[model samples]
Target: MKRIWKQVQQTLRILGAGILAILVLVSSTVPGGERLEQVRAYTRGVEFDYAGWMLAALWDKGQQWALSAPRYWDEKTQRQVVEDWAALTREVQALRAESARIFADPSVSDPQTAAAPVLARLRAREAEQARLGALSEEILQIQTRAVLAEMGLTYGKQAVPSVLYRISKLPLALVVSPREVIRQDANISLLPDMGLDEITALEQRVEQELGVSALVVQIGGVAVYPAMVMETTNLVYLTDTVAHEWTHNYLTLRPLGMLYDASPELRSMNETAASLAGKEIGLRVLERYYPDLVPPPPAP
Candidate 1:
């Protein structure tokens, strides 16, 4: 039993190393020129902590594996959990909107008093939402892996690197493109909750200092170990983003994905390929499981 436990630890360490290698590969894709460093300087204080996030995520994954919780839960339970989460998400959204309206209403002098009920309800739902949300993410990962396996995209009866993702508040990306032409030269991740004023200031600084077009864009997902996906109630979009980011991971091991930073053409090809494959995989998952939620075919 001691030996077996050691083997598990060894496996996890190897997996952690592999994830780190992928991060390095992605960071090296773009040339580290003066302009890139200049942009980094602006984002130095606000950059997302990939290392810390990865460590926390790996620990979470370890807990899930130890419990084997989702595997024991029958299909009915899984479906019910996902459904409850979705319903709860919609309710939370409505509560938030109402709370905003109450606070914004000029007539409501004591906005806090007016919004107390909504706030209380929101606080009450937080625990359940966290539980259901985590389970839903795990279920979707399994479903996506099953779809990939069916598509012959898996080896050794598993999707390479396995399908892993976490739905969270995603980080914002600062993309820098030369004004002379439209091409991505640098993409830096920033704090998810960074203020709009700060983002605007950074973008303006980068553009003015480097003479390049800079934009702080909201990203739905990012290719990281246990890929980062934005929190959303829309199941279809959620699944699609998961598959999309996973596709990038899939490509990372192959020549096409490895050459993603070789040239503008290669980058475009890699992205387009991931986009197409992600959509196909996402639709297949929906068709097999959430058929009712699947979008209808477009008119001819």
Candidate 2:
């Protein structure tokens, strides 16, 4: 009887040890597998959302520009641009749909208790996507205002006299007024030598070139992070652009950012803080340097 009881206890101990080992293996593998799957799934949703918004905005703005400046943009060209944007949008949408289908499979839906870490990672990814989307929207709004301001002179009445002017012999000057003009970068030329379509192409080229150059200068050979361009033709825009760029500079120095390279939420916090700072700095710069050229904030 004593020998039988001892044997039973040993058997129980061996079973418990085997169970523990199995649990450990599963816990280690599940979280990593689940996290990769979830991130891929959520990223698809985010991509869809971003593509839809961008396409819609582009279509709306292009249409508005076409209608407003019929003399500048012909119907065929307008339609072509719209069609191009739509095609890109559709491609992105299809990619998202395929990802969604893969993620939604029943086989993939099987969850393990060990997947908790992966689930947490997925949540973080989703949050970051949301943050980036919000920041993009904010930037788009600013760009819209800049577009309106730029177009206002031709489409509507000029609200302010031209602060930008061309000089034949001397470098181009950004004249706040007759007496208070500043000699900015000699390469800063708003005037394009091409027609509307050609000008658009040139602008894109210039933008890409300048963007790369700026990244090299500002980030010191590091890979460029995600960014959006906001127009800087007006005082409000100038302030915002300065603030936005400065924010990027700020994040490169922080420790929290070191842990996560592509977190949208962290980027948003960095951007928002920089934007606020830019606003403050811009207002002060205007007050000190171009007091006469200060413009009122656009209605929110």
Query: Which candidate should be chosen as best, given lDDT against the real structure?
Result: 1
What's the TM-score of each model vs. the native?
Answer: 0.89, 0.24
**What is the per-residue lDDT of model 1 for residues 1-300, given as tens digits with 9 covering 90 to 100?**
885585477458636755664576546534566777878888889988876786677677656655446756776787778888989888877888899999899999899998999999988886778778888877888788888888898986678777888877888888999998988888888889999899889989888888999999997887777788877888889878889988988888788877777777988998899899888899998998888989988799
Where's the lowest-lDDT run of ten residues in candidate 2? 214-223
Error of 2 at 103 (Å): 47
The Cα error of candidate 1 at residue 3, in Å, is: 15
Superpose all Cα atoms of candidate 2 onto the true structure and report the RMSD in Å to 1 decimal.
30.6
lDDT of 2: 0.35
Where does model 2 exceed 4 Å of error?
1-232, 256-262, 297-300
Candidate 2 lDDT, tens digit per residue, 51-148? Answer: 23223433433333223332244434433443343344344445445555555666766444334555555555545543333332333323323333
Q: After superposition on all CA atoms, what RMSD does each candidate show versus the true structure?
A: 2.9, 30.6
For each candidate, the alpha-carbon lDDT, in order, equals 0.80, 0.35
Cα TM-score of candidate 2 = 0.24
